[model samples]
Target chain A: MNILAYIIQKEFIQIIRNKAILPMMTVLPIVQLIVLSNAASNEVKNVNVVVVDMDQSESSRTLNHKIIANDRITLVATSFNTNEAHFYLQENTSDIVIEIPPDFENDYINGKQPKIQLLVNATNGQQAIVGSGYLKAIVASFNAKLIQKVIPDISISKQSNTTISSRYWYNPELKYTHFMAPGILAQLTALLTIILSAMNVVREREVGTIEQINVTPLKKWQFILGKLIPFLCIGLVLFTVGIIASKLIFSIPILGNLPLLFGYTTLNIIAVLGLGLLISNFADTQQQAIFVAFFFIIIFVLMSGLFTPIDSMPKWAQQLTVGNPLAHFISVSRKVLMKGSGFWNIRFEFLYTFILAFIFNGLAVWSYKKQV
Target chain B: MNTPIAIELDKLTKRFGDFIAVDAITFKVKKGEIFGFLGANGAGKTTAIKMLIGLSKPTEGMGKVAGFNVDTEPEKIKKNIGYMSQKFSLYDDLTVVENIQFYGGIYGLSREKIKEKTTEILEELELTEVSKSLVISLPLGWKQRLAFAISMVHDPEIVFLDEPTGGVDPRVRRQFWETIYQVAEKGRTVFVTTHYMDEAEYCDRVSIMVAGKIEALDTPHNLKQQFEATSMDEVFLKLAR
Candidate 1:
């Protein structure tokens, strides 16, 4: 235990003494939080949309005005022809294009549903899907209004009186910040844990201090656990910062128990730090270490369902995400922050994370040896 | 006379998937001896040293270091031996005193003992003025010497130096050897490996390894006479054949 303390102390000293690491640890996270949170809204609003008004009729003009007033689509410019709209779409200047076909006024007046076209950029496939749903709703509303004005006799003849009301289970206001801040906590955990823990080992290897430690009476398990404890502390600090940023900066509520949140977060960090150590063991050079860490981090974060809902993924993809610890933590964070879930509600995820953390950390220690 | 042998081995061999790195070589070093383990690059000198120090396991052999079995009690062997590598293993980001205190603390030295040893080791190196300076600011020679001092901070029964003076100037090399001699004078075994034939002469006894086998083991003078050469360098050229 004393030897472990010494190792932890040395690690802390190195982290504090190096002026470069201090800002990277404390300042960079805050800066990333501020910049990325604003840019990371799940609700895609204010889509830059282009209009190709082939029909100069008043009805087409009214349809375009409805789209603009809905605030989901912004008509940056009006294109005269399909060629011009094609250029805007190809150049990525517009996320979507609304084309009003010629003779659209004749078709509506003749009691035929006018056919309109929505040219969507599927470059960001998920956003395109969501944006299409949004656009369809707006167009549907416009079509209803058109039918009421142009053909009122067909509208109310078959209608029956009914009442409908809805309530959101969590995030009653549906603020984007409430949804995002908790997910950001998971991202911060993975980023800080992997980078910090890998750096801890790789720096010693680069500087040749590893040989000094290897010669000591220190057990491999002791040394590994000793290294992990400091990073665990660092993870805790990052988690605290994330919580503060959510409550104070974003004004999101933390409705669950703080201690349970911390307890589960600690278990999740073990897996993250273990991944970092595994990367360190594979890389002989620090550059290689950072690269391996980066590659894994990208895969982990993308598959973690941070930017999209895991439920929408295909069965095979969802099965693969089951193995991703970050996905579980993200769910835990959302449950705790948004829904105010208690220990009983989060018990399964907590237990899963604990076992995964144990297995990953065990493999990491198993791969490491005293040999050169 | 009563001090037991610090290192003992019999039929110690290490193999890497059928390639013999150290081929069943047997040797022993008594307490308070400056034993030189000499070899060319890839001649298995490092592999042998690693096995003895418990950093590696022998494929087939029996060995004991500081009375601990190499196979079962490697950690106990670690507690009794100090190791310094060719790369100068002090943390360049840490100050001289910080480095010393860290190693001493990990070695389980009492705070009072660490304080006394820190001052003694610093003053002995005549580095009091720069003890608080980062090791990166120190010269190469100073770093090597500080590394050596740290290896001995726990007062182990034996100190193993693998190519300790590989890249230093001759003057610094000579000073490093003087420290080895001082360490041996204090009755601690100094087991060192080097390629410098001239430095081999400084060993109380030297063993020459060629092709993973010990070709000659004796005092430098006797090995020279046996090889019909006047110096250890020519003796190596002869045995290398």
Candidate 2:
């Protein structure tokens, strides 16, 4: 135990002495939080629209006014011919184009259904889908108004037998930042801890310091633990920084228990640090350790259900996510922060993370050879 | 006088697949003796030292380091020995004092003991003025001496030095041998490996290794007489050829 303490002290001193890594640990997360959180937005707004009105009638003008009044649609150009509107669409000046045929108002007034054409730029699929939804809502409301004028006594609501109201739970406003902040924090914590710890042992080997340590009377477990404890502390410190950024910068609320979050974070750090040590044991050089860590971290982050919902993934992928510690932590972070989930709600995640911690750390210690 | 054996090896061998790094060899070193291990690069001096120091296991052998079995009591052997590798193993980022304190601490030395020894080592090396400076800032000769001193901080029964003075000037090399002689005079066994033939003459006894086997083992004077060579360097060339 005394030897372990000395090792930890030496490791901490070396970390502080390294001018490059110390600032990187403290600054990288903050920069990533500020930059990635704001940049990773799914909400599409201010879609440019071009209208080609050949009818020039009351109904067509009314439709045009409705499209213009909608906040999300911006009327960049008004054209009398489809050719001119096509030019705007081709130039990328407009995301959507609406064309109303001649005699549209007369046909509608005479009880004839007139056709209208909507051309949406499908290059950006999400923006095109959302822009089309706004156009549909405006046209539907216009149809409802027309029906009301034609029959004053007939009720449009009574015409529909069924009504469906959709409610979004956990996030009432569906703010992308709120959903993403916790996930990003979890990913950053895992990435930093895994990479730092993974590179540490191999770096010692490259510098020949490990030979000195190996010749000492320090036990394998003590040495591995000494290496892991410092990184675990750093992981927690990074976690705290991430939490502050999430709450202060992003306004992500923490509705669940704070202590429970920390408990899971501790377990997650153990698992990741163990994984790092395992990599160090297998890698003979710092470069090899880094490449191996990079490969695993990329896979862990992508399959961790950080950006995508696991439920939406295929069965095989969901099964793989069950083994990923990042996935478990992300689930816990999102649930506890967004949905106010308590210990009992996240008990399975805690259990799984703890088991993974044991497995990874056990494998690391077992694979680490004191003598070759 | 019958000085007890500090290190013994009976047919120690190591094999990596089909290639044999250290062939079966037997030897013994008495306590308070300077035993020089001389070998060319990749002649298996390092592999043999690693096995003795508990850093590597022998494929087939029986050995004892400081009365502890190298195969079973490696931890005990580690506790009873000090090792300095060919590469400077002290943390260059740490100060001279910090490195001493850290190595002393890992050896299970108390705070007061570490403090007392730190002062002694610093004053002995005449590094008291720059004790607080980072080890990397020190000159190579100073770093080498500091590393040697730190290895002996635990005051083990046997000290193993693998090419401890490889790249220093002749003056520094002579000074290093003075320190080794001092430690040997204190009745601690010194097991050292060196490529320099003049350094081999400084040892009380020398073993020349060739192609993973000991080609010659005797005192410098007797080996010179037996090989019809005037100096240890000529003796080494004759054995290697």
Q: Return the top candidate by DockQ.
A: 2
At residue A341, candidate 2 shows an lDDT of 94
Q: lDDT tens string, model 1, B1-241?
A: 5758998889889999979999988888899989999988899998998888888888888899899988788889999999998887998878999999989988998889899999999999999999999999999999999999999899999999999998889999999999999999999999999989899999999999999999899999899889899899999988886
A276-362 per-residue lDDT for model 2 (tens digits):
999999999989999999999998988998766789889999998878999999999999999989999999898888888999999
- lDDT (C-alpha) at residue A108 in model 1: 88
The candidate that wins on TM-score is 2
Query: Taking the tens digit of each residue's C-alpha lDDT, what string does model 2 give over B127-196?
Result: 9999989999999889989999999899999999999998999999999999999999999999999999
lDDT score, candidate 2, position A184: 88
True contacts kept of each: 0.70, 0.87
Task: Tell me the TM-score of candidate 2's A chain.
Answer: 0.90
- Which residue runs does candidate 1 get wrong by more than 4 Å? A47-61, A76-114, A117-121, A130-135, A150-159, B1-3
Clashing pairs in 2: none
Stretches of candidate 2 exceeding 4 Å from the true structure: A50-56, A76-125, A150-169
